[model samples]
Target: MKIAVLDPDRTQADLITQVLTQAGHVVQTFGSGKDLLGQLRKDACDMLVMDWHVHDVAPVDILRRAKEKLPEGTPMMFITNSSGEDDIVAGKDAGADDYLIKPLRRGELLVRTQAMLRRAYPSQNGAEQLTFGQYTFETRPGRLLMSGVPIEVTHKEFYLALLFFRNIGRPLSRAYIHESVWIRETVVPSRTMDTHVSRVRNKLQLRPENGFRLVPVYSYGYRLEKLGG
Candidate 1:
């Protein structure tokens, strides 16, 4: 994984960098949140590990700015000294996937961060191209490919498609889909996920009457059935 570390303390940043490096992840260290925010290239990072306190800005503000630049669903972990519920809720509301209380734990970091990344983007699950009837999705590029020609897709649409494709014939609960696609654990109403699916279906030219369908599983959630099924 490619990770960015933002902390005002050089010592702390270096320590994290060393630890992440030893764990087989490429790490970029920043001494201040402002510095990292200014130089951040969101497309280059797989996950972000940031301290709750920074030199020039509040951590939440930095998170908001970072979210503006990053693709939706990028995994973010906030490290803080406070473990209060309010603090955790604030972090989650600010778009962090998970929070780590500082005086860091390497083992926990590796486990939680890896789990969050897998949930957001499950490339390690041995899936390459994902299909729904006549439409094919290219996981690497996050695009809908039709007969090898690329169709434009939103980042949210692409990630949602990945989840639907991974579950193929199985009905996935709304909570299950949200955790897989969105980083936050706050309950997102089912309608939000439904809206995204609707857009993706339209973009991919899927139609229920024509066989390819995005099926709502009654009291359950949703499933994408192949053209014949």
Candidate 2:
């Protein structure tokens, strides 16, 4: 999982990054709320750990903005010295998933982070497999199979396909797809997404005969719909 940490204190940020990294997560640290917000504009992370008091922007403000940009239900944690009831209320109201009072304990941080990830991305938490009709995904081995036959896919393609399978029958906006799969905030060209969609369609053989179809949603993005009844 990719995590973004926003802290004005370099030492605390580094400590958080180190702990998360050791646990096999990709961590990016930002020195100010402004920088973190900027990064979020072009990229998305799996989780966000932010200081309650940031140099340029308030933590609640950042949370609000992040919620607007990130996918629905993206987990956010607040690590700060403020422990007042009002502060806690404000954090939750602004959409923070968890709050950790600072002088953060390494063990507590790890545990809370793992818990949040498990809730937000269950597949990452140890679900070994996911199936959609004839297709099956083996998370542990990072393999995809159709009718018990192996299918070759690139790293990006695999993630993209997994996203579609997870949200089968739902229309996913292009922005959502880009952020979820690429984890970048930069504007992705339409053709880039289109090309990948085309590849996934061909590779996965999503068609009526296969009981599925990966179809474009006009101007929005794409949808993976199950065919037949």
Candidate 3:
């Protein structure tokens, strides 16, 4: 998952970024409210880790406006030095899902983040294998099977296919897919994902005839949609 951290303090921001990165997440850090809001205007992340203070911007105002820009119900956590009861209530009212006071506990932050992500994405039920119609994805060995027949696929292909199935009806942005699957690949080739998506489509027979359609979203990414019964 990708997370955007908004904190002006360099040390604190680096610590938060390192913690999230070590926990298997891509972290983007912003030093000011303007920068964070600008990023939000372009694209949103899976989660937001924000500080309550950012120059002249009021926490409540920024929180309320940022929430309006992001996708509905996206989880956001406030990490600040303020521990006042009134501030906590105001933060929640503005749109924070969770709040942590300054001097954060690394373990506590990770645990809260996991809980928030789990609640937001219930499709991840920790199953070793997942089935949709005749298609089966076994995560243990990262294999795919079709009606008891094994399918030969590269590592990327298996995980890419699994992502679509896990998010059956959702529109997955190209950046999101790349960051999730090719986590180590910093520079992405324009055609790299397209080629793999093509391979997955052809190999899996992801067509209307096969009960699914892998269609491209103009200027966005792709969506895996289920076909008719």
Each prediction's whole-model lDDT (CA): 0.74, 0.84, 0.83
Which 10 successive residues of model 2 have the least lDDT summed?
Answer: 179-188
Query: In order, how many clashes per candidate?
Result: 0, 5, 0
Which of the predicted structures, 1 or 3, would earn the higher TM-score when compared with the native? Answer: 3
As for TM-score, the candidate ahead, 1 or 2, is 2
Question: Residue 75's C-alpha lDDT in candidate 1?
Answer: 88
* C-alpha TM-scores of all predictions: 0.51, 0.55, 0.54
Residue 170 shift from truth in candidate 3, angstroms: 39
Best by lDDT: 2
Whole-model lDDT, candidate 2? 0.84
What tens-digit string does per-residue lDDT give for candidate 1 at 1-229? 7888888777778767865674457988887776788877535577789988775888888888888887788889988885566777888999898988776654456557767877977766343466655667765456677656677878778877766765577797776566556644457667778898888788766676646677788887888876664
lDDT computed for candidate 1? 0.74
Candidate of highest TM-score: 2
Model 2, range 1-229, lDDT digits (tens) per residue? 9999998898988879876875668999999888888999999999999888786897789999999999898999997674566778899999999998867655467768878988998766784677777899886567999999999998778878987887788898887687666653357788888998899999999989989999999889999998798
Better of 1 and 2 by lDDT: 2
RMSD versus native structure for model 3: 13.0
**Model 3 alpha-carbon miss at residue 195, Å:** 52
Which window of 10 residues has the lowest lDDT sum in candidate 3?
A: 102-111
